[model samples]
Target: MLTRRTALLGATLALPAQAQERFPSRPVTLIVPGAPGGGGDFTARLLAEGLAGPLGQSVPVENRTGGSGNVAASFVARAAPDGYTLLLAYSGTHVANPALFRELAWHPIRSFAPVALLLTAPHVLVIRPDLPARDMAELAAYIRRNPGRVTYASSGVASIQHLGGAMLAQALGTEMVHVPYRGAGPAMSDIIAGRVDMIITTPPAVMGQIQTGAVRAIVQTGRARHPMLPNLPTTAEAGLPGFELEAWFGIYAPAGTPREAVLRLSRDIQGVTETAEFRRKAQEAGTYVTFLGPEELAAFTATELTRWSGIIQGLGIRLD
Candidate 1:
């Protein structure tokens, strides 16, 4: 008499559990919240190619660019909480946007499941060749003496580079004008043309100019020397101790996505990041793989979000 009820309940519970374990029976989409040909796209494409072999499904990259990646981020948050739709979220996704944007429907850490830290690229502080300062110490001293005479340009207002500049200025207890450019290209143009005093740009964006001797890379804002620019000293090495800023990229799933699914994705992402293909591609793009699994990535996000929030408020950065 009791057998019929117990059998059905057992079967019903086991079916979904089995399905969750199998995971990714269909093609998966890796959403890039930024334009193609950028660092975000590069990471997504590489991971998709690498993960396909292990997962036995095609992982395609779909670009959903807008609102500094908030468009794609929001799209993923509302997507089905399955393994099929994933996002290539960055430090910007979790940390920078919270303070930068005026109205975001979803909170970064609250809106997504932590997947893995794909990679990080350090920002390089570059100045026009004509400027007098030769290194970080000299640059800090010069800014202190000149006050607002020196202007630092960023890709745009509230961008990571801008924030880094603000943090740097704050740490040095100095003042420098902040010049907001529409994009990195324009910012670099002004730096090269001597229209702007300096800029902190990504390695790929500024490495060429530094090599060609158009702009001098005074120091990097990373904790250590970059493989691409080993000769250049980090800001800490250049006398601004504890000065480090990294443009980091990671993977995430919509919040409420099953824990098992997030684990599966995180494991596979770890596999992909460890592969030779990922390393080679990242190096070519002026990035390096620094994988952090779900727990670590989540904790890092929390710390970074707090860090960025304070920096934003202290500097009075705002979207509106």
Candidate 2:
């Protein structure tokens, strides 16, 4: 009886080893750090679809919204270092959060191993139609001419839109008051009413406003103009060299995840991003593909983390 009981315990312990050898013997879960219907959620679902076939398993998306994404980041950080569990992270997770969340438990570099950097979404430089500015030069002139009177609206404090405004001010060698709204809706409404001088936010956030002629999209900070905003010139084309503000999207797994699994996932994800269908869908979704492998993602994140940390500090923007 003793021998039989000992053999049963040994078999139980070997089960996990056998499963680990197979890598993903079951479905994988991709956790998004935002509510459903958000940009991150949309990208996560799209990526999940592309991954399922290649992974030989279903990749389900799970929304873990709250705590300004720390909730999801910490959850993934604590998850087993296996390929089965992954994170679909936003640029703010590293670039903005580190400076804001002083007590952030998960270090972007230490807590997770980057699988791939998938896309970069650009922001639009929009202003109320009543403003005399119609282009980057004109806008800069208007902003400079107005001095501290010009105002920029954002979804909230420390949001990408807010940072973009600050960057714009810095690039133009001027200052614009930051007006934070509870969300983008209020910001849009006020901007339409000419209550705010400008707003730098995602293309989607201002696409309709631009179309309806409520807001003038003078320039967009993308390599190429968005299909929906063909007339909008990119920063480079607008004669604003090196003045680009974009949100990056990437995938990560818990640190200590097997290198083999990381490489495998990265290669497959690269393949996914390269597909014609994926490209079409991603562009339509306002996410421009810019794939980077594990090492590249790690290095890029580190550089961005440093740059944004200083920028945040200089701006004196802090959030809980």
Candidate 3:
């Protein structure tokens, strides 16, 4: 029974199985669900550079825009369960889209497995310099006086920008019109021209406008102030309690990906986030470097989903 031939046969059979355990035997692709030169694209590329050395494989970023980021989400959700194909998921696509669209091709929780959270930044509230509002209180009075005549611009109908504006109006017991534009650039342009009264958007999108005096930043929509905008007060500090909105970015793999591979990637990503160079770059981009492993990321996303769904339902705003 212990013959040399039997031993050789057993060893031969295990060769393929052992070979399959080595992940990253090939290059990895990180898919971005936004256009090039956008914030998401820039962050993805920065992460990709840091990940390549540690992963021992090139991590190329691929952008697939359109359909409100569904094009990229659907593609990643249907890709092979191996770690080779991954998604650079943003809060908008994963958190807001669930409530924005009545039907989605890919499910945030079911279609993909969380790998790691990259960073987080609270949205900034910007208004035209000519607006009489110096802060949220004055803005509320201005809105109450003008009613629906006070309009706010947003990147899209059900975007975070739009939802933030709605929340602000509800908190102030006032009403304001929403002007939906194709993108934040156009929305910012209109606001700078004083065509729109106000806008709520991510920090990076409004930093230039705020610095150049094109728009006045009344408050940041986070519990605490960010280092990038230390002079700006938080909503609670501005006397508007219970107003918080933080944007996050993370990595995800198609569902059913190997557990070991997911864990390995998470650890590798965390290493990159902790580097000094990465932190400096993220801070300069107006985002704080935040890292969450797989389980933590999943739980955080679940809580966000529940919170956003309630807000969306109460507002009765649904987009196809």
Question: What's the lDDT for candidate 3?
Answer: 0.85
Output the better candidate (1/3) by lDDT.
3
Taking the tens digit of each residue's C-alpha lDDT, what string does model 3 give over 111-208? Answer: 99999999887888899889998887888788989877899987666667788889888887778898976556677888899999898887767787
Better of 2 and 3 by lDDT: 3
TM-score of 2: 0.77
User: What TM-score against the true fold does each predicted structure earn?
Assistant: 0.78, 0.77, 0.85
CA deviation > 4 Å runs, candidate 3: 1-22, 36-39, 129-132, 181-186, 193-196
Q: Which rank order by lDDT, best down to worst? A: 3, 2, 1
Task: Give lDDT: candidate 1, residue 285.
Answer: 61
Q: For model 3, name the residue pairs that clash.
A: none
Cα lDDT listed for each candidate: 0.81, 0.82, 0.85
lDDT by residue for model 1 (98-208), tens: 888888877878888998998899888999889998888788888899986889987555667678788878888878888975556667888899999998766756766
- Per-residue error (Å), model 3, residue 53: 2.1
Q: Give the C-alpha miss distance for residue 7 in model 2, angstroms.
A: 9.5
TM-score of 1: 0.78
